[model samples]
Target: MYLTIPVLVLLVDLSFEKEYLSWKLLTTKVVFGQAVQLRCHLPKQNCCHNYTRSWRGGPDYTLLTLNEKSSNYTKYIEYLDTESRTSVLTIKSFSESEVDIIYQCSYGFSSYEAILQLTRHRYEFHPTESVPVSLSFNGTHMYAKISLEKVFPKPQCYGNTNEKDITKESLKVISKRNGIFYKSMIDFNYMIDPQHCFGLVTITCTVGTSRITIAEQNTSCRKNGSTFHGKHLAQRDSVASNSHDEESNIVGKVLIVLCFHFFNGL
Candidate 1:
């Protein structure tokens, strides 16, 4: 028998183009031990001239220039030059059991945040399951939405607004939802205490044993306070083709190999 594992294709375009600077973000859902490429492109039209670019880690961290200690980030970070129109950062392969990582790009005085999440393919042959999720934020209080894509059996979703970790009772059921690319999205306006949460503000969405988090926001009390307001987002028209299904088949074979270890007690 064959197992049909749904794939979620998110066109995450945190890649922005403005009068000063612009960047291109990675949209592919990356697997373990795979190098990911990200680019910061500067168009000659309205971009700031001679703007120095640097990469930083986490929702809260000084410029990468201050790092004297060695970590995973240093091993993965590549070169950046102001003379070139584009700066490429090629992240080295990550371990399957490794935790999720966030990367921030800064140019001049503007900063953009993006997080890279790790995923595991759950086989239906087993009694357990997993939910595929994507987490993102707009910095603004508006459009602070959490997307629960590629959920099997239409799993129930609960959201909680917390600092660091989610609380048990804060996760309220998210009812207002829409479907996209053969998947589902849940949108809500859960308020955030800007001053209290600060760089630690987060929203955790729970679906059974799986959960996704929205973090590294630069919210403050002076700007929007605790009012998290946002309009509903529409679904995308472009549907994924047969290529993704073929990719699933490749992942299935890898899953079989992983399961073999469990049975053999490796």
Candidate 2:
């Protein structure tokens, strides 16, 4: 008797919903001279089908970029395919003033929005100008010191206008070692929050006619339950030491090979 095996057939159900824009609503912080890009991805091909995309400014509907128009500002928008299913909006250059406006990406019936925030200030220097600044850190604290040769009755901290407003009182003076100078010290207490996972700290210094600003970021690694310190000297020293040891080991291996070859030849 001959027996045949029956093939089992299975029906699979596959259905996809229209794509929606998923993006963070937080503002982006960028340097004055650098460029920034705002991106958005459609949920699925069905949502992008027969749909038009455009960029607008707030409720005023000020058109920044449109699929139909091509100009200097709109040049950043690139159409990827014949269906126009994928697109990217890029800012080739950024300035301090652009931080005040809000940028929005809209597709058919859905939209995503973001604002630009400048967290640091741009410094322009002249041939005769000088900026005095120093940074120091202890195990638990960080300190910034500044000295200005000239004195001003109304010294102001100048930086990105989009940042929070800073007052004159925030500038604290430590001491004046010499009669023809002035000094200021800023004390920063360091703390880690595992729950928040990430944090950003910005420091700004202003003197009689010069101003400077710095930023530091901290992030936590969940797998190891440790914080990533971008500014810690100890971490930097360890990294340097490891690199040096690796190089030394590599050199020792090369030297051993060379000595073996030399003795064999002799």
What CA RMSD would you report for each candidate? 35.9, 29.3
Query: What tens digits encode model 2's per-residue C-alpha lDDT throughout 1-266?
Result: 12322222111111122235643322254333445555656556555546777766533437767773534553344343435344565655544345546777767666777664432232211112244233344433334444443332223342121243323323344434332223333443333233442223345555324555532323223432333454466789999999999999999999999999999999
Pick the lDDT winner. 2
* TM-score of predicted structure 1: 0.29
Q: Write the per-residue lDDT of candidate 1 for residues 172-221, one digit (tens) a residue.
A: 33333222111345454434445554443444444334455432334344
Superposed Cα deviation of residue 137, candidate 1 (Å): 54
Error of 2 at 157 (Å): 15
Residue-level error in angstroms, candidate 2, position 170: 20
Question: Each candidate: what lDDT?
Answer: 0.45, 0.46
Error of 1 at 252 (Å): 78
